[model samples]
Target: MLIEQSPSLPTVAVVGLGKIGLTLAAVFANNGYRVFGADINKGVVKTINQGKSHIRNEPGLDHLILTAQTNKTLSATTSTSEAVARADIIVVIVPVLVDDQNNIDYQFIDGAVQNIANGLKKGSLVIFETTLPPGDTKNRFGRRIEEISGLRLGRDFHLAYSPERVYSNRILQDLKNYPKVVGGLDKRSLELASNFYKQAIGCELIEVSSLETAEFSKVAECVYRDVNIALANELAQFAEKKDVNMSEVIVASNSQPYSHLHSPGIGVGGHCIPIYPYFFINKGLNQGLTPLSRKINDNMAEYAISKIERGIESFVDKNILILGLSYRENVKEPTKSTALLLIEQLRNKKANLFVNDPQFTESEITKYGVKPISLNDKAVSTIDVVILQAFHQEYSKIDFSQFSNCKFVLDGRNKLNKDEISQLGIKYEGIGL
Candidate 1:
């Protein structure tokens, strides 16, 4: 049941006002709780205080922000400590990233902990919503909170871990719909967290035994996807050699109640899938599937570029325009996007590379060391190859004839209409098809 606004509802302090963080704040504010969002970005804070959303292309976010602001139940702040001091519950969604060597970097989480600890009071519940390696939630954060705040774990303050399970464009809906898995440092922390989310989220809550379980469950879920995608990628390559359509095969195989196979793509990129496997693999476990899958998925970028290379004679000065800049379809986030890896390979080959995405500005695309080219621009006539890295809806009805000199279209994602491209006198090839 949606609770009505009441003064008794605990105030929520949401640290990190990124897209997911901000959306969560708005939802909590609407759900009968006072919400204060904290971010280091002053501009984002100012935009929220003015009752406007700085995030674009997300459905209904602007109106939600407006409603929250109008009610004066939500506010923004530049200090995490400032926000934490006024709240009974503090939710930290600060990101924990992996570096190039696949080593976990806790800088952002460490900084957030420092600030949160400074203002953390006794008897408040602290829940971390970021996905971490198995025991880092307790070892990296829980102990640090105790040291800094001078509070006892179960008696003075509460600590728990709950992974964020929402997607980029569907955060609000997923939060209400998805099963929320939560674990705590102890039974006291678990009970308090379960009670808080039971009302704040109003979603079905699954309580586990320990913080490590909640943390591992999230990474395990992501690792499962990475492993399956690697299998699909390998199968896609074999299908390409055997002249079989992997997509059709997958459709047929998935018809069974027991078989579930993921799609094959040029690369797997996102905050979750590509990075989380390392959180498990780096535990120094001697696992075969996990490490091999990581290798296969990471190599997919080079494999895709190799396919394009075999199609053309030389990439020394060829005009190759990449169709999408984002790693995924329709979302503006480019974190660890496969398109970046492809660009690096093509750059080494010295191809004249260009990119276009409907979600990003020209300046944004150019920052990646590639010129931005639009399908409508007259310069499209000079391109030789078109690779569909991301299957954004805007590219569905693309006019192939516009690329007058284009010789091949490589559907890195199996999203393009091959029959239409071939009928238009262009050589069309999709992965595993």
Candidate 2:
């Protein structure tokens, strides 16, 4: 039911209430749209209805969700079919993954589409916010919905593709700041979807010619990052052999307007960077560059390990502490964390291991079969080598030189103060320094 004072806005159903989806639900509700969040997790639904935020990392999201629940604008349910039946607009943002062989797995997305099609109301607009292959939005999902829901395309229902572009910790701000990229099955679908997003998100709407363009644009964004990061990594590796600091070179080269170089790291992780390139590769695009870039980024963990082993005398019993576990700093989700890859390589060398991440509890860290110790603990001082993986803010508060017996600190992110660590008479090594 629509509220009397806010009857002008259409109701919204945000499916797959995970990181991006939950924030989308809260923001839409705060914007005076009655929103129903659909998730299979009953515990998550229960927590949201109680005016609590399931994800604690997103700034201002707790308050946004609380205000929405207090104003009775938002609630959640486990039934996707029921949510779609009640709303005028449906948004899908589930996970799409690649298997070990780099094959696209549509299990989660296919499930969401099936449920959405079951109770899809006539005249309702459907928008997909997941990252998919260039044609999956129109050919796979749009066609499947038309078949299952028995709704004629462009006549009985509308469909659009608007890939979720928000970062993990900056969803609310990105939602209002970034332009919403949208494309549709037809002209009318494009117009309706574009107008709704303009008011609902309170942001500029960037419309494309078709759904394929929108899908391809998102994949291209990830590919750009992946390819550039690979280039940076290649340069850093070469600079390491030549005794030249790649970090300083990056700073100098990126000064001009034409040059925009990314920082090299141990590895590229997260849902998008590591996974999206496979979508095009699976499509059999006769492109060697994308595949080669993916290979370079994927091999970085092994490269990082080799760098550590080159300096360290032995790894048989040396206590090695890896800082941070999540894919990125200050975020809890660890879909394809570089730390996991580093750990695998370290384990092969028979190094005694310990791990720490502020986002995870001590018990949680132990689940990975490693001891968890704090910076102040005596055991931390005995660590032979320290590897900075995620660069969480908590690591910033500690003194790096205080590790009494430490041989060197390998800063994978190159974010540490090189001067300070070196001035303190403690050895510091960045990716190429």
Candidate 3:
């Protein structure tokens, strides 16, 4: 049963007002708990306090924030002490970034735990929603909290690891509807964390035996997708050499009940799939396959460039327009975007590159050192090649006939209709088909 709001509902302090953190804050506030959001960025804090969303393209986030603000259930602050002092539950939702060398950087989570430790109170429950490698939550985070706060685990306070499983665009619905996996240091801690989530978020609470198991489950979810995507990419490459339509093959193959293959793209992007395989490899487990998948996905941009190279005789003086700069469709986040890597490779070859994404501002597109053009601009008609990178919703409505003089349309994603574009006298090629 969903827990109804009472005067006794525990206050929630969510640190780090990033995509996940801000959404979670809104979730708790809408559920009738007082939520205090803490972030290092003053602008983000200000935006949340003003009942506006700093994150873009998230459906219904702004309205949720406004409702929370209007009801006096949500507020934000930069001071970690102020955010957690009056709260009975402190939730750490900071990011765990992967460095250039593929090593897990714990700086963000470390700083968050230290701040939470500073305001640690007796009888309060501390739950970590950040993704971590196996043993990180127990050995590193829990140890640090105990050291800094001088609190005994499961005695003075409780600790748990519950990874956030929601995607960027579907956070609110997922948080309320999805099953929440939680694990703790001991039985008492587990019970406390599980009961709180059951009443708080009103989602089905799944309990694991150890904190490490909970952490590993989250990493494994991403690794599974990454490995499957790598398989699809490998098959796509082989199909290209044989002049086979891989997308058609995939469609036929998926008709079998046991067959479930992911679609091939120019490259894997976003925060999770590109980053999570490293957590397994770094821990000295699944040494070969994990690293190999990461390498394959990472080099997919080069594979895409190879396709462009094969289609065109030369890159010199070629007018190439890349459609969609953001990592994915509709979402504005570009973290570890493969399009950025493709742009860098194209620039090295002295190709004239132009980008267009409805979600990105002109200045944002220019930061990539490429000219920003509209989808309907006259320059698009004169382009020699059009690379459809991301499948943004706006691109679906584009009139392909407008590109009157374009010679090639390299669909980085399988978004364009091959027969239709071919009939229009434009050479159409996609990643798999």
Candidate 4:
């Protein structure tokens, strides 16, 4: 039974109030839809209901969320049933984590679908924005929703897949600007999902053939980045052995047509790139290449540690300071951070470690088993080595001369001025230069 399009604005329920989910909720609300956001966390629900954002450092998002709340177009609740009961469209954006044994955990997504099933009305369209293994959307997710709701997938309710394709900080802009890839269980399902997104997001839609294609597309994008970054990291290692500046080579090589070389850093971080490879591995496909790319990128952290050891002759007993704890610049998220991996390895050597990041508080830093200090703290002068793991904007203002006792500085992101650091009489080592 295909539900006729509502004459009034459709109510949208967005599950999981994480970064991506919250942003999508805001997008729908801003576009004049009555939006209900559902999260299991009571604190998140309370915060959103107060017309404030739980997500940090997103430009224009706070004002957009406040506007949505003021206009009575958006609200949040801890109970998923309450949000989904009257929603004409439901969007699931819960996370799918990869375990240590390289297994994809569907616990979060499964729980969210079960909650939706409890209140799922016939003729409502359900769309998933979370990344899943190729066939998991139709096989696992669609089947589970049907079993829990006692509704046929396409006949009683429409099911679709449209993976979220936005970066962390610029989610709002990317959501409106990027082309959305949408697929569904049937033609009617695809039309409903695509038309809703077309009007709600005001973005171009790329309709694919099936749900499996949509699922694989998102994973493929992340895997491509992971492989490209691994190539850059491998080249950097070769340049390190030959005493050549790999950044210079990269700049020169990228000038040629059809060349798109990624930058080499300590390691690839963030929730998507590092974890998406596991989805492919879980299916027992791409056994050799994907896993090897992951291994190469993973080892870059150890490679950075080896560089720090070489830079400081007496590394074991030295006092070291790490400048950034977040996975990337300007974002507070530490999911799959290479800096965390580096800190873990450094702690095993029994070195006195201090960390500073403008994005995190002192309490957050303590969780990593390191002393928290400000960038301009007086203790920085006594450190033997400074590792620049992330290049936060505030870090650009720091005076490297303050580290008078520092013998070496490892630039993991190529952030420091090599010539300036050399003039300060400190040994400088960068990832590729």
Candidate 5:
């Protein structure tokens, strides 16, 4: 049941106004809680205070902000101290990214902890929503916050790890649909954290024994997808070699109800899937554990890159037109996206590249130093190679006839229907087809 009458809801200090942060803040504020958002970016804070949105991907966010501004239930601040001064609950939703060597770089999380610790008051509940390797909560968040604030855990203050599960472009829906997993330093911390989320969202909160377990659970879920996708990609390659349709084979196998297989794509892209497996692998190597998952995911990128290289080689003097540049369809976040890697490989080969995406503008695409080409532009017809890097709805609408001059269509996403492209007299190469 949605709690519409929470006059005693706790005051929330949401530090980090990014995509995940803003969605969380809006959800709490909309449910009759006093929410304060803090971010280093003053412009984003100002935009929110004015009932405007800084990020476009979050749905119904502007309305939430407008209501917050009108009701005076939500406010923005640049001062961490000011943000945390009166809050009963503090939520940290910042990114804990991995380095090139697959090491967990905790600099971002460390800075956030310092800011929160410096301003924490006794009895404040700190919730770490960022996904990290196990042992981060008790060793890093719990110890650091309590020690720095001179507070006692489970008494003077509380700490918990509840991983964020919202998917980009579908955060609002997923937040309610997905069951939340939470773990804390102690039982008291877990109870407090569970009660807090219980008021705002209708999802079940499964409390675990320790914060480390909670952190590991989130990473494990992501790594599972990474490894499975890697397997699917490998099978896609094998199918291509055997001239068998992998998609049909998957469908036939799935008929048994026990065999479930994911779709095969050119490469895996997304902030979570590509990055989380590395944390498991790197930490295991440090402690002497098997890095089977990491090896598969790392090789997946290389394998997908090889396919693109082979596709490029099939055509001479190829002027490749990349259909999608953003990491995934309908999202503007391209971090760790395979298209960037493919672009780098192509640039080294000196292949002329033209990139276009509906979510980003010419200025955004040009930041990569590649020439920006639009699907509506006549140049779409003149390319020698067209790779469907992203299956954006906008790109799917474009008539393949526009690419009449193209020699080959590399459907990395298996996006184009084979009969449609084949009837157009264009040679098509799709992964797993």
Candidate 6:
């Protein structure tokens, strides 16, 4: 029940060593804070403690890990108790996913809260940085933690919600650029947690009145992107019917200087945009919330998959290559990614699927009971169709000579230049153009 004040920096424990958690740990460690990261995965713990990286995203993860190791200021463990008991501040970043039925799943977050309750000490601050349904962190996690630990809020312990606004590929850059939003159960809770993030991120820390406001802000940001993307998706479909290039149309519209249009793609992927719209739609149903945004984004996936299928109708047994598997380019996370949905839909049609991603290895793909072909393999000849799912840099630099044997190309990302592809003598089609 005692809190220790270290001379160097406050000791912090970051629970759930996923993409966000590990990145935050390294950032904090780089800033001279003593950090202990805990994860259920033993391999992740070993990699961090041994000064190696488990995931690839940030450029200086290895350098940060080495710094943490040399200073003996950062370590990781498989034991959640050891992590919680040793720290004065705890940050939680876990996934809260949605099912096909539009139900929110909180098994991961709930289990993490239970662990925090078991080991949380008096005078320690606990911040929930994961995006969740509005008021769930304040009413659900706060109440449960208090009951189990017998610690009163604002007296013995503190709890707050600080939703992370980090982009997938630009985590390090956004850490300094994006403002941190925090809301808490009480005033003291807000100050304690906001100060911690302000120090590590070195950005503006915005405080809202309550925890639900912070949660709503996070969901609202993603929903805004979803709605705008859906507008582009809908416009793309109409533009195709009119025989107009959607990309050129959007570019022309932007000349007005008042119009900002998002690009259309195979579909909206990633954990945020695809999932957050439902949280708002379902929760605000009685308030007359019509989720036109969620409907459009969800349908775009099926539409793109259907285009791929229709493009190869002449081929009996098809060999299809998906260019990228990760949600977006330059990131390793594939959580709730649209590529899996597209892959599953293609499998149901009994088509031969060949997957290729530079980020993932053959062993990782084998874990899913499916092996993807290497993009570098010259033997991968005579592909019936190729879907450019992710616009990775490697895919951009690919020589047209290698894909000469391919019959058609479906540009889901609209990554290729329209005029240049027509000169290549291959049939190329994109989402809008």
Each model's TM-score?
0.97, 0.95, 0.95, 0.96, 0.93, 0.92
Model 2: how far is 402 from its true place, Å? 4.0
Q: Which of the two, 1 or 6, has more TM-score?
A: 1
How many backbone clashes are present in model 6? 0
Ranking 1 against 3 by lDDT, winner:
1
lDDT tens digits, residues 11-47, model 1?
9899998888888888888888888888989999999
Backbone clash pairs for candidate 2 read none
Q: Give me the displacement of residue 277 in model 1, in angstroms.
A: 0.8
Predicted structure 6, TM vs. truth: 0.92
Clash count, predicted structure 5: 0
Residue pairs in collision within model 1: none
Report the error of model 3 at residue 350, Å. Answer: 1.2
* Candidate 4 residue lDDT tens string, 1-433: 0122234777999999998899889889888688889999989888888888999988888998898888777789877877888698999999998876667888888888889998899999999999999988888878888999899989999999999999988998899789999999999999999999988899999999999999999999999999999999999889888989999998999999788889999887888999998888778765777888999999988888888786665567788888889988999988888888888888888788899998999999999988999866888889998888889999887798888998888889998888888999999998878
Cα lDDT, all candidates: 0.88, 0.88, 0.86, 0.88, 0.80, 0.80
For residues 114-157, write the lDDT of model 5, one tens digit per residue.
88888899889999898888888778787888888888878898
Score candidate 4 by TM-score against the native.
0.96
Give the residue spans of candidate 5 off by over 4 A: 1-9, 285-317
Better of 1 and 3 by TM-score: 1
Sort the predicted structures by TM-score, highest score first.
1, 4, 2, 3, 5, 6
Query: Cα deviation of 306 in candidate 6 (Å)?
Result: 3.4
Among all windows of ten consecutive residues in candidate 2, which has the lowest summed lDDT?
1-10
For candidate 1, the per-residue lDDT at 432 reads 82
Model 2, position 264, has a per-residue lDDT of 93
Better of 2 and 5 by TM-score: 2
Can you write out model 2's per-residue Cα lDDT over 214-300, one digit (the tens) per residue? Answer: 999999999999999999999999998999999889899999989888999988888999999998988986478799999999898
Q: Which runs in model 1 stand beyond 4 Å of their true positions?
A: 1-8
* Model 3 regions more than 4 Å off: 1-7
